[model samples]
Target: MNIYIITGTSSGIGGAIARHLVDAREGVITISRRENIPLSRIAKTNSSFFRHYAFDLTQTGKIPELMEYIFTSFKEVKLNGIALVNNAGTIDPIGPSGKLDVSGIEAHLKTNLVAPAILINEFIRLSRPLKVSKSILNISSGAAHKPYAGWSNYCASKAGLDMLTQSIAMEQSAEEYPVRIISLAPGIVETSMQQKIRATSAEQFPMQKKFADLYKNQGLSQPDTVASGIIPIIFSDKPESGTFSDLRYL
Candidate 1:
């Protein structure tokens, strides 16, 4: 049986991914800040092979304990552990770079960068020891590759994450771990995060027009489309490590 782990299953792409996995009868272990309400709906629709783990990933210290529990609970049938989706993220008030709060930056770093690294570390350690092939799929952003105003902290964190994924993939080649790491820019999707961006004030958000124009003209990819393309890659034997792809590119 293939086992999958996912973060931010509370909503948006995370929830959509979980639902897609269910429809395919792929087993998944989902983690999120709150109980996954949409996952429950998915459970009602397709009940087998899904488990929910509600926890705040921002508390980086708790990750070790969580990993221990997962390993211990699933030791018997763990060979098929396939992918870890680092999908959890946050983008608070958009503002001028100088006006951003220190705490807000730190919060984004922890959730967007540090926590994912921690999870990747634990998953690799567990995978090697347990002898399972695995992959780490990090949901990065276009901001990581292209600069956008009023999103300094988010951009920085994502850029760092993008590099981290590349570095990990390179390291995997050298070390030959039975795992691959991919950093994907999921492009713009219609999510609550977009709603937050649209609500920012003009004074604080100078580049709001760029975002508005993107959404208005380009529209947004449905979460299911991304999930469909990504899920196959997660299970593929092709060398996806160190590659950065977007929905359009896929």
Candidate 2:
């Protein structure tokens, strides 16, 4: 069985990835702040293969507990492949560095940076005993590579995440059983995050017009389309770890 644990699946890119996995006949487990209506329906229809956990990601302390539950619950089953996707992220509090709220920046830092790193570490430790192939997908952003005006928090958090992935990839490079970890930047998908960008004032988010133009000109990529394309990469042998890849470049 190809088992997957994914975060921020209530909607947007994360939700699409979970749906894609299910469609491919892979086992899926979703963790989100709120219960996903569509996923709950899937669970009812495919009870044996689907699971959902409605918990807050900002509560980073609960991550280990959540991972332990998954490990214990599926202990007896022989696994063919295991995947952990740290896809949950926030792009709000859009403004210049001095104008943005410190509280909001703190929240963004925790959700985007801290949570994924912890999950990646815990997954490596737990999967050490399993013989199955393992992979981790860090849903990254273009902000990781280039800075955007009025997006100090978002840019800094993503850059930090990219570095974290790079460091861990090297550490596990020569392990007896290596886990492939890739930080993927899925590029301009049409999701709630885009909507938030479109709604922001030009002064607060200088690039607001660019985002609005994308929406108006039908330039946004569909979340499901991108999800379908990226999910297959996890099962492929290409793209060595510690690499930052973009779907557009793929």
Candidate 3:
């Protein structure tokens, strides 16, 4: 059986992705602030292929233990293959860098950059020895490759995540037990993050109107649709490692 460990499944793209994985009969462990109820229902109605862990991703200090527990309990099931999707993220401190508060940036960094790095490290350590297909997909953003007026902290954090993906991939390429890794930009989906972006003040976010217009024009992709589109790439044999790409382009 295929196993998928994903974060931030309480809502939006993460939640949608979890649902798809579970529906596809893959055992899924969801890490989020709250349990994903729809997925929990699937666990009951389907084949008990779902596990939920409730914890705040900002509490970075506890991630090592959490990851340790997951690997230990599930390591025996490592024969088939396993995948980790670092999908939890934030769009906070959406304003001018000069006016940003320290706490907001720190929180954003902890959630977006630091948490993923720690998780990736632990993931590699645990899965390296297992003789099975292993993959790590970092849910990157378009901001990582672009400069937005009011997303300094968000952009920088994502850019850092992309770099982390690159560095880890490089080390794994020459190793005996390598893990497939990708920093994937999922594109703009109709999620709460878009609402937050559209609700920003025009003075702080000059392009707020553009986001609003995207919603108005029904241009945003559905979360479930995007989630479905991404699974094949994550599960397929076409990729090895050091893949930094956007889902739309793929």
Candidate 4:
């Protein structure tokens, strides 16, 4: 049985992916701060293997215990493969560097960078002895490579995530069952995050008009579309580990 563990499945890309997996009858475990009502409804109708954890990633201290509980709960089932999608992220503190809130900046880094790093560490440690195929897909962004006027925290966190993916891949290469890892930029998806970006004032985010125009022209990709494109990549072995690519180009 192929199993997938995904973060931030309350909505958007994560929600889309979880729904797809449920429809396909694949084993799925989702983590988010709130329950996904639509996903819960679909899972009930499909009778698929599905579980949801209402946990906040910012509580970084409890991640290992959470991961342990998840893995232990699945000990009775035979698993052919397991994958983790580090898709939870935040783009807050969207203003000039000097004007950003100290607490918001801390929360942003915890969600975007530190949480994923700790989760990956636990996943690798717990699944290392198992011979099953293991993989990690980090939902990165184009902002990681470019510096926007007001996304300093977001940019820094994503860039650090990419490097973390690369460094882990290098370290795991020699393991008997090394995890395949990739950091992918999913392009501009039409999610609530985009709405937040569009709503930001020009004084805070100079690129607000650019995103607004994207929405006005219907230039943004839908959540399901991006999910469809990356689902195959997530399950396939075609891409080398530590690779970073944008969905638009892929």
Clashes of each: 0, 0, 0, 0
- Give the residue spans of candidate 2 off by over 4 A: none
CA deviation > 4 Å runs, candidate 3: none
TM-score, each model?
0.92, 0.97, 0.96, 0.98
Model 1, position 141: C-alpha lDDT score: 91
Residue lDDT tens for model 4, 23-47: 9998889999999998998998988
> What 10-residue stretch in candidate 4 is worst by lDDT?
234-243
CA-lDDT, candidates in order: 0.80, 0.87, 0.87, 0.93
lDDT of 3 by residue, 1-250 (tens): 8888999899998999888888777888999998878789987798856678898989999999999898776665635888899999999989998899899989999999999999998989888778778889999988998999999888999999999988888998887767888888988999989999988999889999999999999999999989988888776755557767888988
Question: Which residue ranges in model 1 land beyond 4 Å of their true spot?
Answer: 44-47
Give the per-residue lDDT of model 2 (tens digit) for 1-250.
8899999999998899998787666788889988788766875676547778888878888889889888876776668989999999999789988888888988898899888888888999999988778999898888988989888888999898889888988998888778988888998999998999999999998889999999999999998999988888886776778889998888
Q: Name the weakest run of 10 consecutive residues (lDDT summed) in model 3.
A: 71-80
Best by lDDT: 4
Query: Per-residue alpha-carbon lDDT of model 1 for 130-226, expressed as tens digits?
Result: 5567788899998898776788778888898989998888778866456788888888888888878877877777777766877888687778777
Candidates arranged by lDDT, highest first: 4, 3, 2, 1
